[model samples]
Target: MHASDTVDEQLELAADLPPWEKLASKARALKVMEEANKIIEDFPTWEYWVFFLLFMTEFFLAVYVSINLLK
Candidate 1:
């Protein structure tokens, strides 16, 4: 059988396994995992970015208000 057939077979088998087993199979299969890990490692987490945005926006708003108040 070809590679595609092998993948199909694995998928069919996975369907019969437990939910965690399905996740384990993909986690163990590292074909696309290196890139996925790279992305995970490179990006700041969601919480950090959200806080950064709020802080920057607050800073800018304070500055604008200060300028307008003085005029």
Candidate 2:
């Protein structure tokens, strides 16, 4: 809640972390990207598109109702 408490917590966290360069190393970055791609590849893309189309339909219907009511 206080500034000093926040600074102390951040300092403790910084002490616990590895160096920034090691965290952002090239091999690590590539491995992280590969894992991320695998996760994304496993997603159900058709379900996403189905929800998108449903949302658009509802949105347009709401807009049409509002316009007719205003007129």
Best-matching candidate per lDDT? 1
Reference-based TM-score, model 1: 0.44
Find the 10 residues in a row with the least total lDDT in model 2: 1-10
Spell out the clash pairs found in candidate 1.
Answer: none
User: Please, what are the lDDT tens digits per residue for candidate 1 over residues 22-62?
Assistant: 76655544434555668779999899999999999999999
Candidate 2, residue 61: lDDT: 100
Against the true structure, whose TM-score is highest? Answer: 1
The whole-model lDDT of each prediction reads 0.70, 0.65
In order of appearance, the predictions have TM-scores of 0.44, 0.41
For model 1, give the 10-residue run with minimal summed lDDT.
Answer: 1-10
Per-residue lDDT value at 7 in model 2? 35
Q: Could you tell me how far off, in angstroms, the CA of residue 13 lies in candidate 1 after the best superposition?
A: 26
